[model samples]
Target: GQQVMQIPQYQHVQEGEDFTTYCNSSTTLSNIQWYKQRPGGHPVFLIQLVKSGEVKKQKRLTFQFGEAKKNSSLHITATQTTDVGTYFCAGSTGGFKTIFGAGTRLFVKA
Candidate 1:
């Protein structure tokens, strides 16, 4: 059986602060996908990594994949009110069933 886990189900930060979220899978994954969803909005794909030790960055945000393909992390620097949303990580175990980690919801205060 495969399972996905995430930390700090919720986070609150003031503007100009920083935030980080982590994701872990119980089994080795073939690929890891990160997504973000704004309030009342659908999940939007952010990035996906298939190779070991892959890292990607978008502006003030950084994403990383574990060497074992069973974990990942997302870090955001200089948070803003517009950065308020829920982040989710999904892992695929070389099959159709993709498991999503418990999302980490972020609240940014102005």
Candidate 2:
């Protein structure tokens, strides 16, 4: 069985600050995806990393996959009210099933 886990389940930041969340998997993953879910909203796809040690960025957000393909991370450069959400990392083992980490809840203060 495959499993994905995330740490620091919750984070709080002030405006202009930074935040980060980490995810780990029990088995090597073929690919990993990140998602963001706003309060009272559904999860929205952010990015996907397939290559080992790959890193990608979008505006103030950065995503990374570990060299072993069993870990990943998401970092937000500056905090904002709009950035408040729960972040999730999902890992797939080259199959239809994907294991999702226990989302990290982020709260930003203005």
**Backbone clashes, candidate 2:** 0
In order, how many clashes per candidate? Answer: 0, 0
Residue range 1-110, candidate 1, lDDT tens digits = 78999998999999999999999999989999999999999999999989999999999999999999989999999999989999999999888888888899999999
Q: Which TM-score value belongs to model 1?
A: 0.96
Cα lDDT computed for each candidate against the true fold: 0.94, 0.94
Cα lDDT for residue 101, candidate 2: 94
Which candidate comes out best when scored by TM-score? 2
Off by over 4 Å in 1: none
For candidate 1, give the lDDT of residue 7. 90
lDDT agreement of model 1 with the native: 0.94
